[model samples]
Target: MSTALPQSTGVIAEYRARLAAGSIVFDSAQASAAERLQALWAKLRGYDPHPKAPPNGWVGRLLRRKQVDDVSDHPNGLYLVGDVGRGKSMLMDLFFEAADVPRKKRIHFHEFMQDAHRRFHAIKRDNPGINDPIPALADLIAEDAALLCFDEFQVHDIVDAMILGRLFEALFARLVVVVATSNTLPDDLYKGKPGRDAFLPFIGFLKQNLDVLVLDAARDYRRERLHGLNAWYVPADTRADAAMDHVFTTLAAGAPAQPGSLMVSGRKLAVPLSVPGAARFDFAALCGTALGPGDYLALATHYQTLLIDGIPRLSPDNFDEARRFVTLIDALYEHRVKLYASAAALPDDLYKSGEGAAIFERTASRLEEMQSDAYLQLPHLT
Candidate 1:
């Protein structure tokens, strides 16, 4: 089997070509930031074509040689913070793809922390006497990835906030360069949280270890795309399905949808199709099942946009499903998640004859409001 060749031009050049070709809107600030990141990538790639192994045992040295080059002339990593839809994630993606490195991994920050928690548990299980497993965990990660790119870096969980300082300290010590994108600045991370003072050191550590840059673009690209477009498409049909598919693909930026699961209060909620920043689901997979407010809230928090297909007319026969749908809408509404759905009827016509028909009126109102420009302009709850 033959392998595919990487692109010859740098990331900034490629981005400029896209702008020239009208594939993407031109934003001067975003382009400038991409140029800066491209410089960093060039420095990183130029450091060592052939790395020498550490003075460990033969097996250890061999493993190290296979993973990363020498830790010489490594540049400080990047912390790109920007407003929602300001092209931060898009720039990071380009940087990750263009970087020439033997070992690099790009992942969402929430997923990274989940994996970190699982690894911590496993390491703790094996090394029972160790008081801290973070160093060993960081070593394992460094063995596989010298460059770590994280998207949508938001700190919401206290468990993560408490451990990040020590964990990142160890990773930096091992020369694991990280590039991350977030909506909040380093100083604003975990703001207004209880015991947030304990999380401050991690913020300082991040500031010292990474070159924080802001993508100061004024336009929200996502909202611009949504302008005058119908967020809710009724009479779910072949045309509506195709339109929904196009919208999801556009929002996902060519990333293929993957199957994922969300753990909500000891229950596993299956997501049929998902890419970073968006998810697509069948109405039955969500409302026909026994999902609750917590499950929908978790989904709203995770994805900026949710595309639901095959929303059917509700009746007394499927009262429970209708009730669940109402709760799901409420959760999505509260979180300001952009909702796109192909439905059997208009929101008002969905639940015409149900015991909760009066309550369904509120859900219908919220659904209509969610499609409005005001709701589309609201920032997503992370």
Candidate 2:
């Protein structure tokens, strides 16, 4: 490692410069980790006693080496596990800034899945040769010394669970090293998921190739930084009233702003432009149109209250969505958000198919909460 950075360090030097400018305050252990990584980078680049590797040729090698897995070469992959706001991204940003691999890519876990799923179906028609795009994409990634970094790596969906095994198998088989950060441990990545047993092979694959590392050495980093931070709202603030008024008026309009239409599993759902209602549009129309977990998630995330003109007669598909909907609602409820619904039947009566009655009983608590005036009277979430 050199005290002076070589001019050829190029993009790596610029990334280090940004790291120097970031508002990160590392503690003793983390500071030592950074120091060790930096020292390792110095050793690999053969830059002698130079100050910080001149932020150029010597510095860029650190990021480039992350994608290189050869035993005779620099170390591959970095596992930076910790709670949020621990400067995981900050540390990685320095590495990314210096990385010169043309194929280098980083994506948030949720966002990455959205893209992968979208492209998987979209490209199928054009590239019929590629039955599944995820594995193909992984193979493409293995082509160059491109670094693939995923933030917030937690598996949640059946689609991801089904495909992740093949994707990772092809990736690791091609010698691609992944750098990921997760709140859950590697073995516990998709714990408690429905049909999770089907994904065990991928879990086994990850355990074999990826190293699990925990970065938190003290209290939660987010809590430590915002320990005494206070939230203040002025008496004159009218934002709450405005949001409520919008929801009421929108519901009064009798339909969603955009006409709802989605093709799911060869079923076409065409919702009317409007439904007769005072406080909300037709909930049956909305929920009936939803064909997958994503639709239910979108509904829960966007609307707090749903008033159905007709009580849904639950079917197999509807039952599955309802179960998933309950999970989404529970997550939102845990986050202190509220849900309000008008249904002809109660939770015990809402099932036509599904064996998770015990879980549904727990979910019934949330359904009860939705009927409470506290949730129903609140302004719509923007």
Candidate 3:
């Protein structure tokens, strides 16, 4: 209802506005979590993230200003955890949008890690003798933002898991406040994985640095939304395209889709439409390119849900593209990434006969299963 931003704006107020307008139904769990975020929002008001410098002379050096102001003593942040569609990210986004911070960023955790590794390597390459780049990376990030918010916070790569503890510890020490939304709790992170013992300390450190709130809302709102639409659309018509657009908008919530990059080995693969834990792509962009299993795997790993547009009928004439589509489906199926697409034909009818016919059977079967309720209910495997 308000057209302008105000200094006193808070997440609770925004949530109530949306609730009143019927944009969202009020769940007690979401309301309680909003209160916690509101508390943090209040603490963050008028809180300066920049460190003050002492006089820049011998006296300053003598004083050594060992401390960089009181940034390190800033308030602890909040960590929101819940099942998918429980509104953990929604609430976090509300707080991030309304917070009155001069320097702040809200990013998906996957892309953050990808950039982290890239920067970490660059730092090491630039400074050959620098053994640890985590502190430097943290400092670099802190200079840009005193507040960082992450969506779909998750860790599966051993490399990322190893570096996270140090990276985040340094970030906290620099007075950077972090807010994250995840489907898992702090302790369950990297659980059952090898080298998990070393990761245990990081989990404990995270718990200490942030207040964790669980939002086990009674309904699966995201699933409920999906239930109203057919997961796959046939004939690739204008109506199908409109429906695809709606699906993408609904799943992305209020986050804007942006052109993003995925690090595959050492190469950067371009993602045309990246929306937090979801991505949208035209069939040509995905299957017509010279991409391999590695590229598709990277896509599957990054986006839990994919909205694809204009998947043409597969046949002998476009055998290469058809094969690539099969590879893409295989990767998505393996990762349990939910798919929504506009296609020229149903999965079975799309690949009726050709050189790819034999192997296409598996892909067709997987596509059908992917559209089923049982498959949609399964959690994506990282």
Candidate 4:
């Protein structure tokens, strides 16, 4: 493999330019991964997706190549595995942006699976006699995307785990290339679940189909940035709000701001700004509403990080809000969800001299512990 970059049109050149401009630091592991992505980018340039359906359907043509003439030339995609705070997501985003393929998409794993389920149901509804809708769903995806890049890929739900193996096999059968970044390696994913035996094949499928790159960079750029910027902003003023906004943007990695809803215990929790494993919200959204333990637990299960703005000073007057905030923090602390917030005062000062001030003290102490480097290093539990 040549280390020399082919041209300015691929990932390597863009990475090199970022390095020169001081926008990014030089990391050897990142450089190597960028080179590999560049190789695929060059190959995908003007490459045909071969969307024409055969006279016979997908199953009949499964053994044949997507492009009969280019069977040996199709590039195998990559899977980047690493711990939290590593540059896996950032690098993949860069590669996806620089990739020359006209039919390409980048999506978070959770959203991808949600879309999959939605598409499968629609197909089922339309064709009540259809035996299996997975292949048809795969066809829709393959037609739109030759290159699929997934960020924060992990499986905790049994439903998603059960379907992934069959789904990916169908996608690969159509010669759709896939690239994903995951904190859990293929072998380590979906462990300790009830259907572990059933999901093992999907793990093997991942290892067999994609080349794995372990990104063990010397520095965790995300954690370092968090440390420098001071995630906990006090006074809850406009500047604090702006600072928290920056924190959300940095953690989100250029993902667009979008509102969404998550179902928990048969109810819906509205999300103000949803970004895969990270979420942003105003204080009122959580504490101002009638949310309870189950809702907070759902939030803790889904999001690894939360950016909250406008945390006003709590007193006996707003005891309801204070109690709710305490519960929210308890859920986050228990789940090890990293929190960044704009609060009117320090944790100790919040909810001072209230009826449940003593109870609030424990939440304050937990919040203090959560800001430690050791706590920040801990992985978010589902």
Candidate 3 global CA lDDT score: 0.84
- Ten-residue region with minimum lDDT total, candidate 2: 228-237
> How far does residue 251 in candidate 4 sit from its true spot (Å)?
5.0
Q: Between 1 and 4, whose TM-score is larger?
A: 1
After superposing candidate 3 on the true structure, give the runs of residues whose Cα lies further than 4 Å from its correct spot: 1-8, 51-72, 252-278, 291-298
Model 4, 4-119: lDDT tens per residue?
44766578888898899877789998998888888888877765566564445675465345453453565788999887777887789889988777788998677688778888
How many clashes (backbone N, Cα, C below 3 Å) per candidate? 0, 15, 0, 0
Candidate 3 local lDDT, 1-382, one digit each (tens): 2343532368888999989887789899999898889888877875556544335478755433343355456788888988777878778989998887778899878878888988999999999999888867876887778889988788887998899998887787668898998888999999899899989889987998888888989888889866788899988999999999999888876678899898788898998987767898999999998999999988987788998999998889999999899889989998889999999999999988868788899889999999988898776765
Instruction: Give the distance in Å from residue 354's predicted Cα in candidate 4 to where it truly belongs.
Output: 5.6
- Model 1 agreement with the true structure over 1-382: per-residue lDDT tens digits: 0132322366777787778877688788997897788778776773332243344579766755544354344568999988788888888988898787788899878768877898999999999998989967877777778789998888988999988888997777677789999988999988999879999989988988899999998699877765566778878999999889888877866567899888765578889999878889999989988778888888987888999999999988888889899889988988789999999999989888758889899999999898887788776766
Q: Identify the leading candidate in terms of lDDT.
A: 3
2 against 4, candidate with superior TM-score? 4
Ranking by TM-score: 3, 1, 4, 2
Q: What local distance difference test score does each model get?
A: 0.82, 0.51, 0.84, 0.82
Clashing pairs in 1: none
Query: Model 1: runs farther than 4 Å from truth?
Result: 1-8, 46-73, 252-276, 289-298, 358-362
Assess the local accuracy of residue 212 in candidate 3 as a C-alpha lDDT between 0 and 100: 89
